[model samples]
Target: MGADREGGARRRPMRAVACAAWGILLLAGCASMPDSGDLRDVESTPRQDTEVRVFAMPPRENAPPAEIVQGFLEALTSDDPQYATARQYLTPTASRRWRPESSTTVLADGWDIEVDRATAHEDSGDYAFTLTGSKVARVDEQQSYTPLDGRYSQSVHLARDKSGQWRIDTPPQGVLMGRSDFQRNYMPVNKYYFASDTAGGTGRPATAVADPVYVRQRVDAMTRVVRSVISGPTRWLDRVVRSSFPTGTALRRDVTALAPDDQNRLTVPLNEKASRVGSERCWEMAAQVLFTVQNLTPTVETVALQRADGSTLCTLGADRARTVATRGPVKRPEYLYFLDDKRRLVRILGGTAGTSVEPVPGGLGEGLQRLSSAAVAWDERTAAGVSNDRKDLYVGSLVQGGTLGNAVLRSDGKTEDDRLTAPSWDARGDLWVADRDPARPRLVVLEQGKGRPVEVTVPGLDGRVDAVRVAADGVRVALLVQHKDGTESLLVGRIERDGRSGERTAVSVLGLRPAAPDMEDVTAMSWAGDSRLVVAGREQGGVQTMRYVQVDGSTPDVPAPAALTGVKSIAASDDERLPLVAYSEADGLVRMSSVAQWQKVVKEGAAPVYPG
Candidate 1:
């Protein structure tokens, strides 16, 4: 009876549909499926102009203090050129004081703002409000990106004017907007900075360094980007990087905008202050300008520097500009390394037709077995790995006939999951590892030629450090930390070392910040290019995906090609053009080349790794 009743109820919807369609064809419920050959993918979304403007509602006449404040905040997200609409909510004095270009604080959406009414007093009409939200990143006065995490609060006060209208009497400088508004209002562009390879002895050619920063998409973006490059690196990077632009540098007084000629030649006029640099420094400065501008408009193939007198001081073309001070002495690796089916180290050399897979030579190549994870040094002379039992970490020579030394490090974890993570070797030959033993977690660095490991402290991390990868520069370290809440976070922190003294050195992590906050369950990450990391993770607890993210935690506008699903590990060289290598469940080990397609490189491999 229940089955029949259920069948009757199910047929009621079909009967109603057929009855409703009787006038047309009386076959609505029996419509045939479309032909398989006729099926098509949805049309791609139309590309949007980078400088497109977003409109915001204007302020109403004689609005209350809270309403005026809300309108002003909303208008800040729109492209009003000079923020004319937003200024209406401010007093004349405050309007002149509020400089929207001073800085930008990007907040996550869905922030709740509370407005507190004032009690009846001498300033009874005054109102106070508080803003609270997650800080994603900040563009300082110099327009450099600084990754920020945690909640932020600001108290804003508003007052009623004598004309019976509310206005902001004291307003803050710059602007604050949600990430959604920020995406619509601003676009990211690269600014060039010179290489500061503190660990350069490993023998690798110098490569380009592109510092990603955000600028107003449409409002004089070219001019703004160039000026920002001349302003020098951001505060977080100022001490670790160098710039060619001299102090007090600026554009020529007569020129208001940077324009390219028909033949694709862009001429930038500098004030007398910037003309004092030497020829080599001048070339670097030109390269900086060229890289910054070309990132915006491709029409500019060449750039010429001019003086206040309109005289051409120097000219740099695309070919020579990219080579300026960017070449190092070592060749990049042609093969991606990994662990073979026998748990021995192996490699797959990439080529045009296909790749040749072979086992690496040496004790690690033929003798070592049951390896869980590994890392090859930047010099390609040494390697490190953890035993399958997860109790021993070994360092050995990477060349043929080389020996796998006794376990240099050991784990105390009682379970396999709590064992040591994969070892990573820095450019300076220092091997880093994290013992994930829940009973006694630790982060240690095995300096070259040292018997014991040095413990490094991660000050503010409220979790266990799971993995570690130090940058080639030896100044920054990337850490995969498992938080107390059972979620993993990717963090980058500065590696602060004690000044060179007569005694031995000490190093610790300070000012640790999130590098990929938008991602959860990040399984693997590698340095893909300067200040950029290619990460593999599941976002929002969905299927795993691979993407390139900035070290400053800002997502790029142009998305990277998606990696094959279920990629267990990923490896990338600092050279951005080189293909990325990964190990997946279906396609053993594959290489993702320039075409953004995965080609099988190794038939059976696991734990793929690349030299730093």
Candidate 2:
């Protein structure tokens, strides 16, 4: 009864006067007299628009235990502010203790309610029901969503009040709802913060990293997102990112419902704790706010920070904020590079189809050392290519008279398939590659493509690394791992560097989590945006398909990209304006245009990649 019962046989008829208020009209037959020969269920179409608000009905007088439980579950999924109606089903003490906003548990389907035969009976003063469902994910008090796969079972106790009305005395602490309702009621927004090590100055702009969180869509989202940004980054990203706001920073007392003015300017009044910061730090704080707010609404063009006493701290416009804290790649890639038919590095103008393909300006492009796969640095000034046999890796300059040097690294894997995968570069200019040697597999990083290769320690790793892709942020790395049973999964790990100043550092990849848990076999993947990756993989019993998944292990609300067959490798830019390029076995090297159609770029090319 706790599940969605609107389409069930137990549907209740609404009063005529309340029909219009609910935005639905109930029609009843007045002249029906004949008995039905065949019984068929009549189904009502569900609302597809999120802007349509659904209000929960209050509990009926003298309601039974089951109805009270069902009504409470329904109310949790409504757009009612503060869930006032839902609390009515609970006793005063339980209502006060319940914090619906504390967290949200989302199930694959609405919860099932069944009375406990051991203690529940019609004449019993207290009744107990077990609510159960398959837990799919959860959003904590911080609004951070983490994927889960397990069963959820909670006991809900109801007792008869003095007036003989049933009320819940033991309700779940936080609200629980189905996945469909959660998606409809909440929206994901990115809160921005500066990378810890990349503080702006000295010819380098501090890079902004996106921390995504879910918030109720119609519930003063602007103010909630602003408060979340001020609170600081989530625990997972707190180590690698930092906020410019001072300790104990918060919004001014009595401040709520922050909205932009007619001029598209947002003024945020901070508490006294943030009042003493210098002008430069205040501007950085404003940059964080400006970047975070822009993702929520496009109308906000500028953000002005104010002290508790109403004195202006700093003001930042969208244009200046970008200069202070840049997002994504520092420089746009000029060309999409890949290996040609002869295993030589070649390139074509990015985002353009039918353009003349030319060999890149570097020694690797001369075809002297046939290459299997390659990656170009973000600056487009250097390139790293794996040898045709996939054993030796070479790094060379992209200059007119550049010459190929000796292989900087090598793998001892007996066969090509178990050797070095394609290399990738991060914004910090460091190169990352994975060696799939079964005897001794390792994830290695070249510090600025020089010095000894740092073998990254991946704790809790249960498989060998097959492919590697480092994100533009330089704080996260994505790896395609092959399990013992031969199944491959896509995982993202946090890149941590620890050591003393001016001393040798220890680099490791920690907290490896599945980014595409449902994909049975991930053939390829690429970072498509700040926190989104475009993955090509197959489900347990499904065919290969390409979809976007967030680094936090959640699927995005947007539609999947157009399907391409036999995708061997894929390439995408953090800049969404650029088209997606991939090497498909059926169609050769191809790129998806702005119109969502794949256009052939070359008849024979592989390992398509954009400068990381």
Candidate 3:
């Protein structure tokens, strides 16, 4: 369900005095501007770490049709909680019928409003205006954001009411605003769920997957997020993730506010539907709440689930939550691995400086099998490497005497560029690599890094897969697809495995969507967090740049990492504390330091990677 549905029925109103005070301050600021000066460009204020409350002005008495329309658009961008002021611009019936939370249409710029001449007739007491702009994205009812590239045009109708005041009669169904306003009004938060294939209470830890969604920054956010958790994962991720909350679960009807206590413990009150779950299931439910809530605020260290009758269902703390469900890789990698000057696998401690690079303890690292690129497994005990020729893939252990096995997979492409790409490991120990052979491109995975390769079916692939990086959760894969126009775009797809037992399980990548749609060429990318990626690419007609993007295709609120030139391959650990390692054409292997500056790691190296 989308936020604020049912006409913001669940939303609480902001204090009237607070809204009035903010209005006075806004007017005062506008009144204080200099009357005359040479016009200078004013830089936009940086996004605030704390919420910025905005209260839009209501329509003036006897306002004109254009003024009414303009007022409504501005009000949509305010933090008015229930958006009561925005509704004041509409007729009584329209206000009652409008569903502002149905969805949000974000345009590249604020919409252009112009009178629709054919439909605007002063004598008829009616006016029609069209809203036009370049649509950049849309947040659906489930709060799943999707990048869009197209024109947006919507018509709104207004008429004079009995009070001789202009009011909108046919307002747009959902809220609409520009990208800047959208950013100011919403913030992304991750809701946690266990992988559909894993069960929580088992001996093995259930893998937690992040399902990101946007919510109003300060509008009873904790309560809204809790409700979203009860509503379940967004539609796009529903098939691959499962929420522990029972079917029809929801917050008790009268429960509208949720806050952590002084000790940073939050108690969620659920409806009767969740009152009868088993203790194990309730703990899983609490674990889900803990993980989800912690992302909103690190201070929330524990979550206690309570039934509608005010009885505790289960209480799970952050420490215990980790054991019940793991997010991304369970362990931080001891060292970052890469191909050294000798084309052999080598390693350096993750967060230390002045550390000497040393060969890994294995045949692949013994300078015997020259490697083009490599991926260390989740446990750091095993590694997969692509031969220097890019035609063969080898897997070996990190033990001192371990020998590299014969090629487990081979590409018969005619040239190095057309052969296998670099390999990536997932949390499940499965290895993924794509063969870029033009005649027969294939995305294949090796179960446990052994046995016959299982070709992954990509249903809507329109180009050759140039690179593959499976996220540590093992449910999403990032692919660099080369199009016919010679441009490469980064796309993310969901990994779906059929419910068949044994080695013959069916696997396919579905719902492939552009993760970096604005980029004309995505040269390199890596998963930098649970649902964020560090991407190096260039926009159309723009210079190459590095930025962080969420899996849902939205840019992160934080600033981009320190800039670097000619980045060829980038690698990052889900543990963001570790430095980012990248291979640059101009600087060889380098890593970002604690100061956010890129420092040379070695005079010569390539394909730097941390354990998956």
Model 1 residue 585 distance off true place after TM-score fit, in angstroms = 4.7
lDDT of 1: 0.71
Per-prediction CA RMSD (Å): 12.3, 4.6, 5.9
Q: State candidate 2's TM-score.
A: 0.92
Which pairs clash in model 2?
Answer: none
Best-to-worst ranking by lDDT:
2, 3, 1
Clashes of each: 3, 0, 0
At residue 112, candidate 2 shows an lDDT of: 68
For each candidate, what is the lDDT?
Answer: 0.71, 0.84, 0.83
| lDDT for position 537 in model 2 | 86
Q: What is candidate 1's TM-score against the reference?
A: 0.77
**Candidate 3 residue-wise lDDT, 138-201, digit = tens:** 9988778999888987889999888888899999869988787788778899999988888766
The lDDT of model 3 is 0.83
Residue pairs of candidate 3 with colliding backbone atoms: none
**TM-score list, all predictions:** 0.77, 0.92, 0.92
Name model 3 segments beyond 4 Å from true: 1-51, 499-503
